[model samples]
Target: MNKTVNQKAWFLVLPVLLLVAFSAVIPLMTVVNYSVQDTFGNNQFFWAGLEWFEEMLNDDRMWGALGRQLMFSGIILLIQVPLGVFVALNMPKKGFWASFCLVFMSLPLLIPWNVVGTIWQVFGRVDIGLLGHTLAALGIEYNYTSDPFAAWVTIIVMDVWHWTSLVALLAYAGLQSIPDAYYQAAKIDQASRWKVFRFIELPKMMGVLMIAILLRFMDSFMIYTEPFVVTGGGPGSTTTLLSIDLVKMALGQFDLGPAAAFSLMYFLVILLISWVFYTVMINLDKREG
Candidate 1:
């Protein structure tokens, strides 16, 4: 006889479902409404019928911002993943030191994002900041406000400093889950460290690594506050990612139609890329299992 599945479990999740609908679905519907219509003063809206989307698609400024966003996400992934893995590998496996390291690694993740940005903002000032003063004292003319390259580097470095710990903690947890038997077997086989890592540790950590990649990619792709606080999309739009440009259009230029269209497109891009990452992770799990 086939056992009947419990239908009562749905009751437990009904509230959560309602909450999501209230918060996410409602806001998304509002954005969709805004995207498809044009608004004039006095809260008047008229049928626009994809006009704003077409305009946004044709805008070179939007495309440039997209390029910058992609580049930043790519660079962040490249740097953070490897560096985080290295830190995880080097951490003490178990001890007081291991506990200390764990706490230390978590500190950066605990700091508020806006606060982190504010700290960096002050920390990078040319005259008052330690970094800027030291660079200046060393005879290097480094000014983020006036220099595009410096601004980019500063933001990239600041992001790495703040988020690499997250990657490291995730990788470390993955490493901890590996059985000691694997390492012992590798040692018995006279395997070199590189060989063991390549054959064993890397595969074991692949699941968490994919997760780290997905989280970092999504976060970096949509990053706004930190860079905005640090650079204000400045040095002449050199650091102006898509989110920054969208805000500027929405609030600064008061182009609500275009901003709404831009937001929907941005949401779609993130959803599509995240789905890809999720698909890859699932396939990897199947292959490994």
Candidate 2:
């Protein structure tokens, strides 16, 4: 006999669906409309078809921004993932110190993104900021505003300081989930530290590690307010990522059509990479199961 489906659950979900439509779907539809049309003030819109998309594709500035974005994200993953895992591995697994460490590690994550950026921006000032003043006193030329390399380093270090704790916390949770039996077994087997990690802990942490990678990748890829506040996309656009460029197009330049198209493409890139990461994560989970 076939079981009857519980249709009443739909009632509970209806309000959430409506809210999502209002909050997300409506705005997305507006972006789609702008992507295909051009307006020259007076509320008059002309059909532009894919002209804006084509222009964005051909724009060297957009491409440069994309390159910078990818490089930033790549560097973040390279630095944060390994560093986070290492920190997690070294953290106390249990006790009073563990609780203290958890609270301390969470401090950076608790800070708002804009506030973090502002803090760094002020903290890097050569005349007053400790970091800048120390570097200056040491006779090292350090200026984030004028030097492209310094700006990039500042942003990268700022991001690392801000987000690395997230990865560490996640990895720590993953490590905590592993049973003591595994370590006991490793000890009985005369396994080395590296061997135990490779054979037991690393494999167990794979799920959370994948999650950390995906999260950091998406955040780093779409980063805006922090770097914008810190660098203002300056030193000759060296630190300008796609989000900054899109804002400049939409608000700064008031070119809605191109900005909308650029945003859609930007959304697609994030969606595509996220899908790839999700697929890998799912496959890994399946294999473990």
Candidate 3:
């Protein structure tokens, strides 16, 4: 006997397919069109072919922005992943405190990105802001606007404060999923703290950690608005990550062709990194299985 597949289920998925095409594919097509052509106002477009792509590839500024973006993402992963794991380890397993902690941890994630940036912008000011006033009183010169180093530090710290909680919460959920029986088995084996984690908890949490890293990497690579609102890509282009540079090309400079090429390259870099991360994670899962 031959078996028939359910064809009607596709109907249920049609709306979602349409939505994604509209939201993602349509915008991507627009970018692709712009990437290969130049318009000299009045909708008069000239074929530029790969000229913009070549220019962007040769641009020192593009390379610098990419370097800065990678650095930012690397630092964020280093800081947030460990910190999140630590926080999860220390959190109460079950009780009102757990509930309270969950709510508190989620508060940062709840805030809008732009609002978070604005808050940090004010919070970092040398006058009227608590951090600024305290640092000033302590005889330290700190100004994100005028100092490149300060601007970099401020953006890194701000991102950490905003997004670390997400990693912590995901890690906590992963920890909670580990059975109590595992801990009991570890105790019976006379396992040390390191052994328990290395053998049991760490393995279990690997999936969630991969997810957290992937999310943070993508976000950091594409981060705009927040850093843009805060630094405005000032202090000598220190914080001009790819996204910032792309915007500057698009709106600031009004060079649509170059901007389009920059954006396509930017998208490809993210896609490549994400693919690598996903492949590694899939392989790890296979090994563990």
Candidate 4:
């Protein structure tokens, strides 16, 4: 006898579909409408077609911000992934220590994004903050608000501190999912630490590592709050990534049409890159299988 498929599952999914439509789909459509239209002083909208998009495409400031965003994201990924893997590899496997470590690792992720920015903002102050005061006492100039390199370093370090835990946790979960037989097999082969990790652990952790990479890349590309709070995109826009620039254009300058166009383009870049990542991941899975 053939087993019947569940016909009632769609009924259970209908509420979720409605919620997604109302929440994400509706807002996105509104944004698309704004991107292609112009609004006057009295709140009347006129169809502008691709006027804003053309202007944005030719704008030097947008390109600069995009470049900076790419560099920041690259640096963050290069630093975090390897370091996180190392930390995860060294963490205790089981016991109260493991639970305690896991809880501690998750603490940073639980904090609100704005609050994380605020904490780092005050924490980096030169006078009252421990980091600034210590650096100043050592006769080093440590003002992120003035110096470009200093501002970059401050934001990079702040991001590393806030997000590295997420990578570590994902790596840890991947490591934990491995069977003990893999380790025993490696030992029987007289595998070194590097060999064990390279041959056995890395392949097993590939899925979660991809997830970690994707998460980190997306978050880094769209980052605004922490760096905004810490450096305020100061020192001659040295740290002004795309998100910060978009906010400045829309809110600070009150430029409606260009800002809307900028946001749409920005969203498209993210969507395209994320799609590429998904496709590559699918192919990798197929190859491995």
lDDT of 2 by residue, 1-289 (tens): 9999999988999999999999998999999999999988677899999999999999998899999999999999999999999999999989999999999999999999999999999889898888888889999999999999999999999999999999999999999999999999999999999999899989999999999999999999999999999999988899999999889989998899999999999999999999999999999999999
Off by over 4 Å in 2: 1-12
Measured with C-alpha atoms, the lDDT of residue 271 in candidate 4 is 99
- On TM-score, the candidate that comes out on top is 1
Deviation from native of the Cα of residue 135 in model 2, angstroms: 0.9
In model 4, the Cα lDDT at residue 50 comes to 93
TM-score of each: 0.96, 0.95, 0.95, 0.93
lDDT of model 4 at position 48: 92
Q: List the residue pairs that clash in candidate 1.
A: none
Model 3 C-alpha lDDT per residue in residues 143-220, reported as the tens digit of each score: 999999989999999999999999999999999999999999999999999999899999999988999999999999
Residue-wise C-alpha lDDT for candidate 1, range 9-79, written one tens digit per residue? 88999999999999999999988998988887578889999999999999999899999999999998999
> Top lDDT: which candidate number?
2
Question: Candidate 4 — worst ten consecutive residues by lDDT sum?
Answer: 35-44
